[model samples]
Target: MNKWLQVSFVILTFALSGQAYTDDSKVSLPDDSIYHLDSEWVTQDEQTINIQSLSGKQQMVSLIYTHCMHTCPTIVATMQNIEKKLPQDVLDNTEFVLVSLTPASDTAKVLKDFAEKRKLNQDRWTLLTGDPQDIRSLAMALNIRYKKSDDNEVAHSNVFTLLDEQGRIVFQEVGDINKVDETVARIVSQ
Candidate 1:
């Protein structure tokens, strides 16, 4: 075989393999992934980010109102505990997302205050508030039911949902924080 021909064949094979690898890396999300929701949210820092922007990391998602006097605080505490239990590597690749059920009242400033009061790690914790309809749509997609009570509190179901790196719900626990170990296991396995 001629030297030039051999060299050219090697280069061509490498290029083709590179192209194949690139194509394989672009995996499509599942049809039911939360990234399919076109909702816009404002972070505690007042930055506008779309729901799909959170697609690349594992996420622990919950719906809450900053002003709630009961279940909301419990939910936040439970999430914090879960964060503490996660392995550092899993924690590094995970985000804890709290979406406001009362978007009208849970402004960016309010969310910021709530985050500060709870001593949440702002880097890993995202508190979001957006259009009421968008919030409602997100809650519905997560199967979280909630309503405003006469006393001005949000009466919501207690639940914690774990979304895989691709934004598909991998595991969800309804009611108390008893499933923290299971949630951590799922995240680590992912």
Candidate 2:
């Protein structure tokens, strides 16, 4: 009877452990993950990269145009402020992505120049430009609305999108560019 009890306990332990391992191995991204979008982008260095290529890292994304005289600069400054407040570890794991609304004018060289003028960190920041249709598709996926005016300036709303390591949008802040403390707290806690 004692030997039989020992064997049963061993079998039960093995069965439970096997089930747990299977569950852990089957972890998957949610259906609505933004990584599912099939948008390709050209980096400031002229390298072409797909949105999924940004997977495995947390990302903060914004839409902007280089020619804007008002809101774009403020948006960039807000991003810079957020970066400054993040802890070193969080900063290391995060990527700041700026997608150009004026893809026709904001070529790789233009994007690179804008980054340099702003003194954005080359390693942590990525500025992208691509086909106008592709850019519009990405904007739609993120729910960002924008349109070019008769004067060629982009009329758009201000939104900062925060994506998790899997590219799922975990948080988003609209308007009030300076109200980022909650966003910072979310990043730190995650």
Candidate 3:
């Protein structure tokens, strides 16, 4: 091939790849809708972590507890699958976070253990457990609802929210946890 044609082809390839690698969920959100964090959040680590701290980066947000026997696991598994599907370049820029709604049941030790079992990247994934009231505050802000059972089981929404780089909510899915892949693709591509 001629040198000019070869260089042109390489540049075109890089541009196309970069476009393909981005998460485009921002385009999916209603044009008038805004994405913003409701309040500063404190973690069970006794460390303060404001949702605004996540600004300028794409993020996947979900609610779960370490002790759950069923739906929670499915939620986590779906999240892991989403991570796997994402390109490495996008994955590095994106963060996956799980908020422990059952603060009492999800201690730091338990969250650490769960992270270890799942082989999740400590830097990339955050398992947060704070006061139940704080959890409720955050949940309400995210439009997530849940109830505690007498037997220690908790029933919560199976929803996941994808926030764009600007901290605006892009997509919210409420149903089978398996749909995370497609929902996330919309965010990453935006």
TM-score of each: 0.81, 0.81, 0.72
Steric clash pairs (candidate 1)? none
Per-residue lDDT over 135-156 for candidate 1, one digit per residue giving the tens place of the 0 to 100 score: 8888888888888867668878
lDDT of all the models against the reference?
0.85, 0.85, 0.74
Could you give candidate 2's per-residue lDDT for residues 133-152 as a string of tens digits?
Answer: 88787788788999998777
RMSD of candidate 3 to true structure, Å: 14.3
Supply the TM-score for candidate 1. 0.81
Model 1 spans with C-alpha error above 4 angstroms = 1-27, 175-178
Candidate 3 achieves a global lDDT of 0.74
